[model samples]
Target chain A: MKADTRSGTGDPMDGFDTTIHAPNRLRICALLDTAGEAEFAVVQEQLDVSASVLSKHVTVLMEAGYVEQRKAVRNTRQRVWLRLTPGGRQAYQAHLAALRAIVGP
Target chain B: METDEAIRPTPQQARATLAELERVQASTAALSATPWPRWFATVLTLYIAAIPPVYGGMTASTQWLLPKSAWSTVLVLATAGYLALFAFAAATWRKKTGVALRLDVLPKRATLPLAIGLPALLIGAVVAFRSTGQPAWLFAASGIGAAVSIAFHRAFVRLHRKTA
Candidate 1:
């Protein structure tokens, strides 16, 4: 498929970012965009993916500055929470719009 | 003949990926809706139902059915219990949902009606109370409040299911 030349800013197809195009990463962003924040175990459970697989995808998103993590103590146990940053949300939404554009308006 | 082997998405592949994303998002929304908010609304409806009987001050004949002191005590305890239940429900909701609840995921079309309709119902309650000098009018208000809360909750759940 030919890459659309219209810039991602003006035309969503133009903004197709490679970093967020991976299947797991896309799923992570989609979930985070809706949940706002979710515990690591919860995300893994929902995705039905192994913790290692989730961790790898999360690392990729985090490296791209699209995802953020926080730590909290719950029930006397330390837990990690994940959420999309504002930038990540924008990127993910744009990617969705780009997908729609490709699919047909 | 050799074929180009580098993996790339065709428009059909892009469309399929988009559909899968939509399916995942829909599932996320369904899971995100949780039951906590509905439970909270149910308890709130009960609390609202208690308001008229407790606060409107019983009629003279009605007061004669139970000693005023005992009646007031029961009302106070019931009110306290309802409030405690609300707090418990809210906390459980927060924990069970795995995050702070996000009503923002609900379509604006779904929320806009609730935002407008609830206050409208309350205002109508006030109008009814003012127009008719009957304190019993409050019971109707409480009933409507409870019903509306439940309806709004159901509407949200239904919308989530339909969209999903």
Candidate 2:
């Protein structure tokens, strides 16, 4: 995993985060960014991906320090909830900015 | 070896990625906009409306309407019932939409004021009623609280639609 050195200043490309650029990871960030915190199963359903596949992407994001998970019991079952860390949120936003810059108006 | 040029997305690819992001956002927004259960709104409104009178009765020096003992029971029951209902609503909403109910999603500017103001308004009414021995203050506050509750619910729904 590469270090995410997204300096808030400088060219938009400086903020482009490779860790979050993968399509599945990008979609996960978008959903968590909007929803705040989502159950792991919920996220898997939204992405229409297998649990193992979603878990793999989530592990990559977690290793990058872009996402965190919470474990809790709900309805007599253990559940995992995922949310973006503040650093993660900042990187995601910056990545979006970089994408917009590339796309232009 | 993959060069920087090979790694970075071209403008066309960026555009497509952005479009996909927009689609994800739209779908998530739509899911989040799932309407609150009708009973949830009605019960919440009634709970808000009941607060002032219940507190007023609890604090009244003279037994204004109900005995102090009864007021205590009402207070306990109402609070417990409202909390249970709130938990049920949140759980059901999550089950239905795959999105958790989140206060942080609400605009902070609007939510902060309501968070502070609603309690202040309701408690203030109780205090005023206590000092003056007037039930009218309680009734007035109840009406205002109920109206505010309804208005906030509608605003939340509107916000979800607009975001979607």
Candidate 3:
């Protein structure tokens, strides 16, 4: 997380996490924050992005330790579910706060 | 090299990002609000409504309906069946919406009271019926339980929309 020194808003950027700053990654965090957990295919569909594109962003998030994946066998098929780690959720929330601050009331 | 100035977004960019995030959240909310199958509510209501009478039957002095031993079995089967139905509903919802139905998503302010009040109502009714030997207590509890289940379903849909 980086402080938004540019704005001089002392405490506002405390949650500004650059790891979640990318557009698709931000959207992913927003969805996971709301849903708690969502299937990968569902996320890909909801985001309306190619699998490769979504996977690329997901890999970045995963590497950042912001998101975790769960693999399960359901309906005789393997399914991957994605959710934010606790730290990831905290970082995402902080980023949201920072964004709101930048946007003002 | 990306300068600090280049790394930070301007206010206008922040506003745009916030708007887009809201759009994504709204879409997720809409998906979550997908209506449960009609039977979901029906089964839930039926299960809740059945608890008191079934419990009363198990503990009642009179054994006219079934032997005292049989009521326990009935209660267990009923509970197992309800759990199975609940699991099925959750699985189907996940398949349909690609999002799992999560009770934790609901506001604790609302769910906490429900978690406590519902069981209290049903169990209280059972205790009253056993002490008084009145069928009316069981009937009243059943009706209220069913109504509460229906109302909760409606409230869940409304809450999702309001949050969205």
Candidate 4:
């Protein structure tokens, strides 16, 4: 393996770094960034994506250390909650700031 | 001791913090996680019941704005066209936002509104008691239409969720 770059780099976002973040991932990050934390159901509902598709994208983000997911029973129903890690938040905010700067007048 | 430091919220800082809070609230509203079905029922009940009396008041107030027949015709047609356009818009918005219209529009939704929804139904009742020959059943019908819309809404939510 290429030094498991995620573990090797001490940078907050070393593992989660991406040169070409896809639209869906970016959308997820934007939604998560603003919401702080959210339920899988709600996220799926807003994004209008299939559960499997969302799960796949979320898994990629999780693998990249950009997300955290937890499972629990709420009101006798199984629910999944998600929040971004500090590294995830930092990366998203900086990336967003950079994008805004790029589009600045 | 009394001449202590002044703790003040600078206008610019207060505005920035308020702006951030409003943004967070809006985002949470967009992503409200409550089941769309219940949200649908509650919202449709409240608004369908609430809107007609206001429209009627507007219609009555504006009666002298034109002749009765012409005015009523224009008003009814305008409102109907607007409602249809609104329904179309809501459906399209449901597609775009990936949630039921009601759920997509509110912050921290709950089912308590359905009980309150009944009172909203009686707004037309109160209007009927005040006005002569008002079609009180119109209110009932409105409530029924709202419930029916919930069915369509749930389907859209489920379908959108599947396709998204």
State the local distance difference test value for candidate 3: 0.83
Please tell me which predicted candidate would have the highest lDDT against the true structure: 2
Q: Which ranking of candidates, highest TM-score first?
A: 3, 2, 1, 4
lDDT of 4 at A44: 80
Stretches of model 1 off by over 4 angstroms after superposition = A1-9, B1-8, B37-39, B50-87, B105-110, B155-164
**Number of the top DockQ candidate:** 3
Pairs in steric clash, model 2? none
Ranking of all candidate structures by their lDDT, best first: 2, 3, 1, 4
| Docking class for candidate 1 | acceptable
Between prediction 1 and prediction 4, the one with superior DockQ is 1
Q: Over the stretch B1-164, how does candidate 4's per-residue lDDT look in tens digits?
A: 01111332234543443344445445555443333445435555455544554444444433433465764565576667657766766554443443334532222233345446545554555456346535454455466646645744565455445433
Model 3 C-alpha lDDT per residue in residues B7-117, reported as the tens digit of each score: 668889998998998889888877777667789889889989998888889889787377867878888998999999989998899888888676665568878998999
Report lDDT (CA) for all predictions. 0.72, 0.84, 0.83, 0.54
Which parts of model 4 have CA positions greater than 4 angstroms off?
Answer: A1-20, B1-164
Collision count for each candidate, in order: 1, 0, 0, 3
Residue B74 C-alpha lDDT in model 1: 69
Give the per-residue lDDT digits (tens) of candidate 1, residues A30-85.
88887888889888987899999999999989988999999988789988889999
C-alpha RMSD values across all candidates: 6.5, 4.5, 4.1, 17.1
lDDT of 2 by residue, A1-105 (tens): 112334545776666777899899999999998788788988898889999999999999999899999887877989898999998998898888777777765
DockQ for the candidate 4 complex?
0.04
Off by over 4 Å in 2: A1-11, A48-56, A69-80, A101-105, B1-5, B158-164
Q: Against the true two-chain complex, what DockQ does each candidate achieve?
A: 0.42, 0.41, 0.47, 0.04
TM-scores, all candidates, are 0.75, 0.78, 0.85, 0.36
Give the Å error, residue A59, model 2.
4.0
